[model samples]
Target chain A: MTNAIETTNLTRRYGKTTALANLNLSVAQGSIYGFIGPNGAGKTTTLRLLAGLLEPSSGEIRLLNQKLSGSGTEAQRLVGYMPDFFGVYDDLRVWEYLDFFARCYGLDHARRRTTVEQLLDLVDLTPRRNDFVQNLSRGMQQRLCLAHALVHDPPILLLDEPASGLDPRARVELRELLRTLREMGKTIVLSSHILSELAEICTEIGIIDCGQMIVSGSVDAVRQQLQGGSHLRIRILGAVEPAVEALQNTPAASRLPAIAEVRVDSSDERVLHVELANATEETQAALLTHLVTSGILVSEYHAQTENLENLFLRLTEVMS
Target chain B: MKNVQFISLQPNPIIIKELRIRMRGIRPYAILTIFLIALVAAGYGMYHLMLRQALFGGSMLSFQVGQGLFSGLALCEICLIVFLAPAMTSGAISSEREQLTYEMLLATPLRPASILWGKLVAALSYIFLLIFAAVPVFSVVLMFGGIAPWDLLKVFLLLLITAITCGTIGLFCSSLLRRTSQATVISYSAILVLIGSTMMAGSLWSYFSGPIWQPVPPELLYLNPFSALISIVTVTPATSTDFFFGGDVFGLPLLSQFAAGVVHYGPNGPVVLPIYRATIVFYLILTVALYWISTHLVLPRRRWIPRWSDVTFAVLLAVLIGGTWLTHDWWRVLPPPSI
Candidate 1:
């Protein structure tokens, strides 16, 4: 698959302070790429560079296979950019606002009407088309901004902190809208401090800190790269103290260092948790068998996997 | 051809959007009503004042009344336009940035020049609407007799040009300043300097230069639209023709030398001073150049002129030099010998 967006040594500097440092990023076509960072972490700067709003101090950006530098209007046509905060004219009706942007994208009269109506329908804002923009709620305004971004139907969309002020229901709506856009084969590169939001929607993730990309890859790949091993939860029905004691004395636990530590659950007294170190499924099975054979009352055992949140926390913690 | 076709196809969305928003509110209507009432009240007061003065009898009194009414209303209109233009235009671009819509507008395929033109045209159109509404009030002067239809037309044309020039200055200030308040202040201050200082400078030069040479130097008067308006309204062909360049310079007759206010060439022909003409043309060129530079300032990377804006600028300078050469008669220290 061809890359939808690519950058080479994209560095943006503000005098002595480096906003984005020697960053190279690749977002595959049709993939939902989430840019993760803390406040003042150059996420907005990177998106602005991609949107062609800010010229790179020294670098190149390619969107939809077109070189962005000095390409003029041709490169801008291929990407739709929405900044973190944008204002709407209060006097203009919602349809007029979309119509104005659609016209700016060079849509003709007939096409502007049709496109505006279709977008309103897509964002579920058709009822408010005749209503003034100022009268709409914040969530509606955000949806309107999203609809504004989609006016030209560009191949790539760069959104900055899109779900920042949205309520949970609105966030869910925005998430669903993004999913629908992904289904239509639009490459989305969005930056957000809300890791949970990104984790729920992003197929690919790039974590940046102090102006450098710390880690970037597929969501599962990044998680696996940070995860040490698997975790096991063992629930004992009666006399949990004996089960814990027996597990510590088991020969399999001593024979294989993969069974690193076993501790009782702090919240639940009846449950015991086991941490593995570089352990495979076979070793896990052997440990389980030895535990049963040792005459310990182990009622149930299950493996719990490490998620993207754990990976994010571990990587960010290491950098900090 | 392709560029022209592309430009022709792209309707200026900014103009349509701005006009819709401006006209949708009750503010413009209120402004129009107040503006017309003021003009009518001023015109009526002048006519009533002239009626009480019985120094002239019959037709002479009527003509004086007409002239007084027309002159007062025209000057009032000019002052209103000069003040109203900056209010309409100084916020054109800065307001967008203040409202946070500038970035989104820039992100689209719209060029900075298009945005500037759209803003200027929108601002001027509102002012023009006000000017148009006052036309009937000015027409009441026609019922008495001193002013001709052509004179009213000249006044209206000069007002339009002045408004456009002032609007451009406001836009340039708006583009340079980040805050709307700052832009408005700078725009009004620049207009005041352009209007007030030029008149004051001309008067001072006239007082110091002695009475033999035309006081209120025509050259200096050419720089101020208000002075140009006064010269155009009062000077007649016979009074002004024989005074300069044998009533013709560069083989073009002076507009002031014609009773009908038309330029005619020859020794006996009307010698129009063309002070207003020079002012309009000079201001138009200045406005265009200023607007071009402001567009570049807004989008420094994607300039209207690709790489040759500097070259284009050099050419503009050359044109200014050439124009000065053509108008050598007007700027001379000594008055031209009469025929």
Candidate 2:
């Protein structure tokens, strides 16, 4: 698939401090690409560079295959940017705020009116269209800012920490809205310091630390690449001691592979935590059968789930 | 494609937004009302003073009273413009930065020049309103028959131009400074230097020259709007013929013998370029230059290297100022065909 956004050796420096190092990034069209990083890891800097609000100390950026150059108006027209921290104009109504931006993009009177109405409806702010912008709640103002970014109808969005200050309900609503946008074929790239925030919604995730991309790909693919082996949690019907002994006593010369390790759960002694050298459906079935046939009743056996939080912590730990 | 190109030429969106914000509040109305009241009060006081003088000495004539009223009103308006014009615009760009709206505005496709122009027009339009609002009080001078309609037009035009120049000065400072308070302080200081220092320097220069007949170079007072307004109020057809012949220093009759000359040695011998015309030309140039610099300062990623158009603009400005200086009398208004 073609990339909606691409950066080659994008670096930004303020004096001797480098905000973003030489980095290459590619975001596929119509996908939600999450940029995961710690604070001051150049997430905001990267988004600002891509939005053409800051000049890269060195390197290039292209949006939708067009080189971002000069004043970047052409490339800027294809991308809408929502900053992490933004202020609403005082005394301006919601619709007027949207209308002002629409006019800035040079939309005509007739088109501006329709566009404002559509954006108000899309952000679920139609009820508050006449209300002053400063009077809106935090979540409502965020939605209004999002609507402002969409006024030009850009095909791509660069949102910086979009869910940072939102409450749980607002975050969920924002996720649903993003999914809707993706369905409408708009590529989105958003940044966050929290992994779980983006893990569920992101089609692809890029882990960045210290101004570098550590890993990036489909969720499962990244997990598999980072995790070399699998862990399993097996609960025996009776005491877990006999099951542990049998799992460990399997002959090294036998056709069945030896289990890597076995240990009882610290909280529940009935359950055993097993580590496998390599896991597959057949091997797991073979292991389950061996336990049951040996008069060791196995109540439950399944591979343990590894959340993105653990993966993020481990990845950053390795780098540091 | 053609439609898109045309849309780019439309009026800037900032002007519309700014004007809406400015006109919606009651503050603008209150300020305008106070401005008119002050002018009317000053006009009433001047009229009574002239009446009392006439009754006591029986020397002050009706036309003299009219001239006195016109002078008093013109100076009051000048003082108001000097104090208020910069205040109105010094916060234009800096306040946006303070409010955190500057970045969003910059992110749009709007050009920096468009933003600066929009701010200038919006701020100066209100000042223009204030100037126009006092038109009735100024017209009262005509009732007594000393000030001409043409002279009133000249005074209003001077006020408008002065407001534009001062507005640009404030905008330039606002673009340079990050805080509105700093911008305002710097803007007022710059204006004070322009008005106060130049007059002091001119007076000192005339005092040191040591000869009553030596002409005070007109260049020193070109940036002083007050001097320009004073010259306009004092110079009349009856006095201008003597003015050219070095009869009296228009308004400063007591020091006329000491500062009797502003003669420029042109090809046609001594050419007298009116201070008002010189000031107008000088301020017009200043306004354009400041506007250009302010636009560049506001640009998100300004090119430090000068472009071809920039170089050409610089050349044109140099030529315009240089040419105007060399042929100082070209702008001289010929005395209205001797009745």
Candidate 3:
């Protein structure tokens, strides 16, 4: 897929302090890409650069096939950016704030009203549309910020820790809202330190550490790339005679390491503990063959996988 | 064609929106109160000055007295500009930055230039509103004595120029300083250097003159914006036309022209003094350049241009010594020039 957002060697500096350095980024057109990093990891900087808010000291950024940064604002109009920490004009009610922002995006009065109403409803803020933004709870304020960002109906959204600091229920509500948005085909780039939160919602993840992208891709792909990693956990029943036979005969499975350990830990319950090293597509087939051929009444077979969170820590820990 | 088409589309009006937001806050009322206090003090001074003049002896002092006596109104307006400018603009952009709205606003399609223009227009609007309130106070002068309706126009226009120029200074400081107090201090210091220090320098320059009271060529008055404005507006109401649009070196009114008439005894065909023309053009151009730079300061660029706040502080020390030398009464071998 052509990237909706792309940056190459992008860097920004405030005098001697480097906000972002040698940054490379690409977000697929329709992917809900989670940008995970610790605080001060330049996630916000990267988002701002893509939105054309800050000019790169050196390097380039492109959004929707057009160059971003200085002297052009087309990219800005196309990207909705909600800052991590921001203050709304307290005097304006929820609907008024949305309407004001919609007007800022150059929306007409008639269209602004409809867009405001729709965005408020999407963020579950329709009821509080007439209430002052300041009076809203922190989570409601965040929902309002998200609603404000959608005023222009831009194709892409850059949300900086939208769920951070929100109550658990509010966070769940936000996650569900983002899920609905993704289903509706809005590309979103969300940044958060809460790995599990992103794990729940993001289709893909980019792990940034100390101003550079260590790795990024689908959750499974990233886990697969970890040298010593297990992507799937399987539970088997009835002695696994058919599976063991299928695994032994499978050509691809034959190349992988043998079951490293199998213990009669649950003999009373008629279960076995097996560790399959170098788990991959090839190994999985051979292992499955052994089970099917055995016909040993295979009862439970499921996978509890290690996801992007482990991959991120592995890459960042390796760098350190 | 593209440019024209761009213009035809509606403006985002982001600045105006922000300004409306700002106005709803306490700053507007606070600024208005300060502005009104200055005007009241000035009106009181003007009434007393007029009363003193009539009581002391009418026609004894000359038109110069008439002009100098009216200086209280100009002073009042300047004080208003000085006090309110720092309060209004000093906290403008920096407060937005602190509030974290700066980056959000920057993220929008509103260019820095548009933001600057929006801010300046908003600040000027408030200042104009303050000036608008003082209109009746000056108008009351007409009932008592020789103050013309044209003089009132000149006074208000002068106030407008002072407020606008000072507004630019305040805006520049706002962009550079992160703290409101720093912005205000820097703005006031800039005004002192730009206006007060020049006057001191002129006074000291008198020590080196060929003759002390020689007609100092009316052009020098432009150094003080108040003086230049008065020079143009004080011209006889009949000749106010000659000075308004793109004429002469200075922003002086008809009175300064009459003062110019005291010297230069030749056939009159409006011999535009190059020095006066250049000076007025320079200041006006400077004001425009300031407006332009302030626009860029508001841009959402990651890289910021070098700020001159530190350099300005250093230069001010030099100006202080230079001004002290000029204002020294003992250094003058001849007496000061009469009004």
Candidate 4:
């Protein structure tokens, strides 16, 4: 797949402090890429750089295979940026707000009129078209901001902390809206400190901390790469001590070569949480067969996947 | 193709937006009403005072009454320009920063020059409206027949130029400073220094020149709008046409001693350039330079960094060269009339 946005050694500095340091980023067309990081972790800086709002101290940015110039005016047409913190103009109606931006982009009058209506409708804010921008609720304002970004209909959208200050329902609505945009083939890159917020919607995730990207890939790929291997949960009827002892024995260890470590669940003694070392489905089946032949009553056997929150915490902890 | 480009640039969006916001509310109308009322009251009072003087002196209404009333109204209008012009635009860019809307505007493809131009035009348009609204009061000066329509036009032109220069100064400060209040304070302070220092310098130069009747060089008063106005209204056949600082109405004892013309010896005779013309030229150049600097300051990432002082130095150099070129006849001497 072609990359919608690409950066090589992108860096930004403010006086003696480095906000972003030698970062490489890539987002494929039509994919939702989530940038996960803590506060002051250069998430906003990276977005600003991509949005062409900040000049990079070193390195180059390419959007759709064209290198961005220093002024970023040409690239500005291809990227729609929604800043994390923005203010709406007072005394400006919602449609007028969109129209103003449209005019800024030098859109013709007829196009501006239709574009404003389409954007308001797309953000589901058509009902409040004439309401003053400041009078809208926070969530509605966010959507309006998003709508403003879309006025030019850029193919790539850079949203910084788009879900912050949003209620659950608003967040869900935002997600749906993003999904709709994605279906229309926009490469969406959004940032957040919360991993769960992006985990469900992001096709790909990059965890950045301390001005560096720790790891980036498809969601499952990052999980697998970070956790090293899958985990198995085994529940045997009655005496779980036998299963634990049997799994720990040298003979069983040799037979079940995939088993790395076996521990009984602290709360439920009959359950065993087994860590596997690079175990495939065939190896899991063999291990199950060997356990059953050893006279252990097995009631439930399944793999327990690690959640993204635990992975994020563990990854950041190790980095720090 | 050129026509298309020119057509696209008309009617900047910021001007439209600012005018809508400023005009939609009742505050501008209220301020305009109050401003007009004050001018009328001042005019009425000056007219009555002039009428009583004529009555007491056993004379009919004459040119002196009209001239006095015109000067009073013109001075009042100049004061309004000095105070209101800067206040209108000092908050133009800084308020955007305060409202957090500056970044969004910067992110667009609109050139920085367009933003600056839009802001200046919007601020000065209202000021121009205020100046033109008092035209009827100014027309009352025609009844007594001392000030001509041509003189009235000149006065309005000076007011317009003064407003533009003051507005540009406020905008420059607004772009340089981060907060609106700071911008406003600095803008007013700058105007105070411009007006105050010029008057003081002119008076001091006349004092130390060794003779009471010697003309203080016109360069000192070229940037003072008040002096320019004085020079314009007080012109007569007896006094040199462009002489300023000849009037002693403010009780400055030294002003009465100064000659009525800024005279420079030339091969032929004394040369005089109208102080109002010099003032207009100097201010127009200044407005352009300040507009340039403010545009650079408002940009998110300036392509080139030229210090404000550097621009100021360049402008001063241009003014000096232009001033010398405009008065080049002073450089041609005839060896003391072949003594």
Candidate 5:
């Protein structure tokens, strides 16, 4: 399948500083790709380049396989971009602002009106249609910007820091709107520092640091890459010292077959949590058998489900 | 054929958008108000001065409400035009940079020319509106004097030139500077240099020519658009003369009144000259050139962005200024000693 965005050796510099350095990126069609980075990581620069806001110093970009160039107006016709911070002539009413964009996108009169109304409803701005943009809350303004971006109904959307500065509820709403857009088969490329937001919505995530991509893959793939060892936690009803003693004495817990390594997190009066390395089903059976044989009770056992925060920390820390 | 016919810019939607933005702000209006009050006051003062002369003095009383007779008021109009031009155009690109609207605009299929063209014309039109607002005062000048309709037309045309040229310079600077204030200052400075630099150079050259080569080329003076305009209007009279209305509006100024102005002022008083078409041509072409450069520099395909070029030009200009000062022998040199 053709990619939605493809670049080859893209580079940009500002005087002595290089903003993007020989970077190559590809965003598959019909996928929500989250671009995560700290400030000055060139995420915004990449978005701007993709949106054709800045010319590349050297190299090339393709949106849907068409070469990006000055005459690629048709390519731009199929793309929608929401900048990191955009101006809304604060005095313009909501519908008026949306309608202005619709007109700019060259929509017909009836279609433009219909499209604007539909977008307003989609972004839930219809109730405040007559209010000026400045009067809207930060979240509402963000939704309005999203609605404006989608006014053209393009196939590709490049949103730069859309959820930045939004309240928790507003961020949730933006996430939901993005989720809906993803369901509609739009190719989305969005950048944000909020790892969880990305983890919740992104099908694919790429972590960039200092203008270079350090890691790119699915959530589980990234998780497994960061997983140093398998960790198993157990809560017990009986004394933890005896249970630990029993497990230490029994081959099933410490020297169980099919186990490569083991680690202890904590030993409390009632429980023991441990980390294991490549512990298999046979190793678990042996450990449980030894526990039963020793007459030590096991309350609960489950694998730790790693959150994206750990994965992001692991990846960024690797680069640093 | 398909490309040519598709997506026609029927309404030029930007002009209205820009006009709204330019007019909505209180600060812009406040700036314009100051100029407006000044024009009205000066215009009224001129009318009253003429009225008194016609009423009490035995003079060749000629009366009519004109835009303004004195160069001082005209200079103020020029200052107002040039000052407001930067405000309109300096915000053109910098505000977009601030709001990331430039990204939004770039995402559209609109050609770069279309975008810049929209902005330039918008800035120019705002300045034009300010000039238009003061037209009533100028119109009053015609009621009591032998006012030449063509002369008023020329003045309006000059105002258009002043605004467009200065406004384009401001827009060009805005494209170059990320900070709007810096863009405004630089743009004004550049415009001042463009307008006054030539006059300064021409004056120095005339000083050096010292009657030996004074008439070598009268056309050299025309290199400055301001000088070219004033020269054309001031030197010719046949085209601008109101031969039929040459007499005062009250006709012959009641013969007894003529003695006051006549005896007091001599035949040496400045005569009103005929309007010149050449002035219009010079200003219109120069305005067009400035506009062309403003748009051309903004082409997306141009690898050169506005800021770098402007900075480079600024450095070069400083070097030239330093070199000129160091090399020019403005002071007389002593004759070489024994060499």
Candidate 6:
């Protein structure tokens, strides 16, 4: 599949400090790409660069396969960007705000009217259409800003910390909205310091720290690339001690190259935890068969999926 | 296709948006009402005072009373325009940055020039409305007959030019500075210096050069907007009159030195005083140059000196030098160089 966004050795410097250094990023079309990083990890700088609000000090950027030029209006037309620190014009009514942006995008009057109506509905701000922007709640304003970014119907979206100040419900709404947009074939590059924020919706993820991207790829691919290994949780039907003993002597647990270590979960006596140096479905199945055959109370058998937060920490730590 | 072209030809969105907001508010209308009412009361009050003097002196010329009223009103409007232009414009771009909306604007398809002109025109349009509202009051000069229609037109043009220059300087500050309050302070400070320094320097130069043959120190007064207004009005009656007051005229009175001298001519024969023309052109070119700089600065992403902007600057400098050469004869007639 063609990439929707690509940057090669993109570097942005402020005086002697480099905000983003030799960053190479590739986002596939229609995928929700999550950019995770700590505070001042160059997430906002990268988003700003992609938005064309800041020119890179060096390197190349291609959005939707078109090389960026001076001013980047051509690339800007293809991307909708929502900055981390953004404010609406409090003096303008909700519809007027959207209408102004639509006009800037050169939408005709009739189209603007319809687009504003549809966008308000999409963002669920139809009731606040005539109200001044300042009258909206923080969450409502965030949604309105999201609607404003979508005014031109750009194919690629660059959102920096969109859920930063949002309440849990508002964050969920934003996630749902983004998911809908992704389903509609829009390539989304979302950046957030919150790891859980990117966990559910992102098809691919990148962890950046100290102006460098530590790891980036599909969620599973990144985890596997780091090879931080897998964690399996097995709960016995009766006593955890017998299951733990059986797991120690099992061929799949001892001889299998994938299984690195096996031990009982200390907090819960009935649960046995196994750490695999390398895990594959075949190895997991083999272990499960051996546990049953060895006469361990095969009540629960599961392979835990590595979460983005853990992988992010591992990658950022390794980079540091 | 026609409809699309027409839409594209419409005014900048920033202008439209600002105008719509300003027009909907009570502040602009209230300010307009108060401005006009004050102008009327002040003009009539001056007329009443002039009328009493005329009656007591036994030479009650209606033209004299009208001139007094027009001068009072014109001076008041000039002060108001100077004050209000910066007030309207000093926050034009800075406040957007403060409000955190500047980034969104910078990312849009709108050109930087469009945004700069939009803010300026929006502010000036309000000032124009205030000016137009007083047209009936200014027309009072017509009843008594010392002021010609052209004179009123010149006053209006002066007000506009002053507003444009001051407003552009304010915008330039707004673009360069981060905070609205900071921009406003700098803008007002710049305006005060522009208006005050010229006259102050002229007085000083006149006093210091008293030993030698000193003209009316056109070097210092050339950029003074207040002085420009006076010269425009003073030269109206005798189109061929010398607006530059020559001879050693010192102090504030030197501002009106246009009174006694016969007109002088350059190689091209007699023309309007070059200082007056230079003041107008100076402000006009300065306004345009400041506006271009403001637009350049307001871009969220600006290179220190892009090759294109460098070339544009070169071309502009070339044009300025070439134009100076073309108008060499006209400039030679401006008062002799002084400190």
Q: Write the per-residue lDDT of candidate 2 for residues B1-339, one digit (tens) a residue.
A: 112222565578999888888887699899899989999998898778667756665355577667777877888898889998899899999998888788788777877767888888999999999999999989998998777899899999899999999999999999999999999999999999997787776667756876642445666777888767766665332243332221332212322232222333333343434678877888888987887678678877744556555675687778878877786775443321111
In the range A1-320, model 4's lDDT, one tens digit per residue, is: 87998999999899989888899998999999999888888999998888888889998999989898888775568888888888788799999899888877777777778889889999999999999998999999999999988877888999989999999999999999999999988999999866787989999999898889899989989988899888999999989888887777636445355568898899988889999888777777877887898899999999888988899889889988
* lDDT tens digits, residue span A5-93, model 6: 99999999999999999999999999999999888999999988888888889999999789987577765588888889997988899
Worst 10 residues of 3 chain B by lDDT: B243-252
**Residue B276 Cα positional deviation in candidate 1, in Å, after optimal superposition:** 2.1
Runs off by more than 4 Å, candidate 6: A251-266, B1-7, B52-60, B212-215, B234-275, B302-339
Error of model 4, residue B78, in angstroms? 1.9
Model 6 chain A is weakest, by summed lDDT over 10 consecutive residues, at: A250-259
Which portion of correct inter-chain contacts appears in model 5?
0.42
Model 5 stretches with alpha carbons more than 4 Å out: A8-26, A55-60, A70-75, A245-269, A279-294, B1-6, B25-40, B51-58, B63-79, B133-136, B194-282, B299-301, B304-339
Q: Per-residue lDDT for B1-339 in model 4, tens only?
A: 000111254368888888877787689899889999999898788777656645565243466557666777888899999999899999999998998888788777777778888989999999898999999988997998767899899899999999999999999999999999999999999999887787777767746776543456677777888777765664331222322222332112122332233333345554333577777877877887787678778888854576564576587758766875776555322222210
lDDT of 1 by residue, A139-218 (tens): 89998998998888888888999998989999999999999999988999999878888888999999898889988988
lDDT of 4 at B43: 79
> DockQ of each model against the real complex?
0.40, 0.39, 0.27, 0.36, 0.41, 0.38
lDDT of 5 by residue, A1-320 (tens): 99988889898888788888887888899999999888899999888788777777888999989889854465567678898887777867899888777767777677778888889999999999989899999999999988888877888898999999999999999999998898887899999988898999998888888888777778667666667555566676766667667655545336564333333444454556665565656676667777767777777866675777777777778788
lDDT of 3 by residue, A175-242 (tens): 99888877877789999988888878888888887788877888656656664634333445655554
- Which residues of candidate 4, in runs, are more than 4 Å off? A233-240, A246-272, A285-301, B1-10, B54-60, B202-217, B235-273, B305-324, B327-339
State in Å the error of residue B161, model 3: 1.0
* lDDT by residue for model 3 (B65-122), tens: 3444354555566566756765667666777777777777776665666566677777
User: Could you tell me which 10 consecutive residues in candidate 2 chain A have the lowest summed lDDT?
Assistant: A250-259
Error of 4 at A252 (Å): 3.7
Pairs with backbone N, CA or C atoms under 3 Å apart (clashes), candidate 2: none
lDDT scores of the candidates, listed in order? 0.77, 0.80, 0.65, 0.80, 0.67, 0.77
How many pairs of residues collide in each model? Answer: 6, 0, 28, 0, 15, 0
